[model samples]
Target: MTQKTNIQSYITIQNNEIVLNGTSVFKIEPTDFADFSKQAYRNFDVQYPKFFKMDALSKLAFLGAELLLSPITSGEQENNIALVLANKSSSLDTDVKYQESISDQENYFPSPAVFVYTLPNICLGEISIRHQLKSENSFFIFDAFNTEFMSNYSNILLNSNKADVVLCGWVEFFNDDYKAFLCTISKEESTKYTNETINTLYNQ
Candidate 1:
């Protein structure tokens, strides 16, 4: 059996961007979600040439994946990495717009482009392409942070040896407030993590 390892990282993108790696990185006020998406794409150096016209879901996925993969030091373990995410909206914002577009007969045509964002898991696809990761992926939605689910599922993946690393977090985009926090876990014991440690950090 693979040994258990846990490592943690935190990212806050609210009024400003703050990344905790023992200290704050920097902060900037994004004009909007699209602007934030563009900034992230550039930061990760995503090579996709046709990103602009992509649907909002795809755009967010692209940005999320870029953030997850940027700090990875073990791309060599691509086969053993999993992308697990939880969000509150579950693409409802996109679905709402899509439904509105079709609600009126005068503008009843629903574009396939907009329809695609209705599902929350598309972000996994964007991440897979960005990192060339072919490992397991999943997306879950709840009214609030489901710590129990996140911890249980991630532990299962690691203990089962199905993956050597797991990237798990919360990514929510609601109106003007957007927040994301991601952490990585492995089978090698590292000084960086523990259940107690995580709880303490989170409480702070």
Candidate 2:
């Protein structure tokens, strides 16, 4: 018998609002991404001080992962879970800030802090560190959310035993706009993991 993968839980954040499993858990007035993220962090009472230091992309990813993975106790499922995240912008939002810091030859101030987040996968690192998920992880850049790739890749990871569960989705932050739709997949009798369902949750 083939093992079936199912979406254990899903969370979405966009337009200053956060929805988990089809319920609007948090919503705030229109504001900049920085303030919105901070408010969400406080509203959820997430106590990771390092969250404040992350770039926009990392902060967005961290918040989604934090909420989606909340039911599972930290350190309980150490290396069984994998993270596979995709985005269209690919950290360009942070790249712009980093460039400005060193753009001026005379006033060139290259910040190691900002420089570190130039890669999109850094968001994965932030989540992994927080959850202690030491397993296969990858970040892909696509013109849009590739549900086919996400479904296939996650299914392989789960079926092959590369990971007992796969947490994958899109975390996109560019300009002042941001959206995150993260989901956990495992062999459970719930929402069947499929391309259509992934698209539906993302659009929801």
Candidate 3:
């Protein structure tokens, strides 16, 4: 038994450009991830001050989730939204920074701020906290985006009543290269939720 679902809304953040539901909403000159994220935060008028303190990975995912979920105004919808994020790097960028901090034996000092974002799923926590989402969430490290797993897992959650909507996609950031393709899935009448569609949105 397969539960049918559709992508209610989708967002892509890449190449210093942001597109929401196939419409270009924001674009900036090429810059480092930190500066780009800060510019985007100001451009979108996001009021989250903690966003500035997040690492590159968390900033990327948080911004994507912010744009994609901005329309959900109801508390029930927020609580029922589950997160399913996958990435290839698995927080390696931050891991490298953490390693550098403690690499020097004589000056071995670990920054708790850097250490807190060592796990890839920490970005999920950032998004969850920002949106007050207490729903089920999971992060997977795949060689690439596992569309089948994303699609199936989201469908299962929806059919099982675990979530009314699922926010799932890929958010990968490492070595100054990054991309985020996030979408909301439910039984809504929009783009069909399938492997091909997922791939298309990701590549778009």
Query: Which candidate number maximizes TM-score?
Result: 2
Looking at model 2, residue 17 earns an lDDT score of: 95
Error of 2 at 171 (Å): 0.5
Per-candidate Cα lDDT values, in order, are: 0.67, 0.90, 0.89
Residue range 48-91, candidate 3, lDDT tens digits: 89998889999999999998887784545546799999999999
Ranking of predictions according to TM-score: 2, 3, 1
lDDT of prediction 3 = 0.89
Top lDDT hit: 2
Listing every candidate in turn, what is its Cα RMSD in Å to the true structure after a full C-alpha superposition?
3.0, 1.7, 2.0
lDDT tens per residue, model 2, 1-204: 559788888999999999998899999999999999999999999989999899999999999999987677466546578999999999999999999889899998799999999999999999989988889999999999999899899999998889888999999999989899999988867734454478788887
How high a TM-score does candidate 2 get? 0.95
Candidate 3 displacement at residue 15 in angstroms: 0.9
Q: Which stretches of candidate 1 lie over 4 Å from their true place?
A: 1-3, 18-22, 50-61, 71-78, 194-204
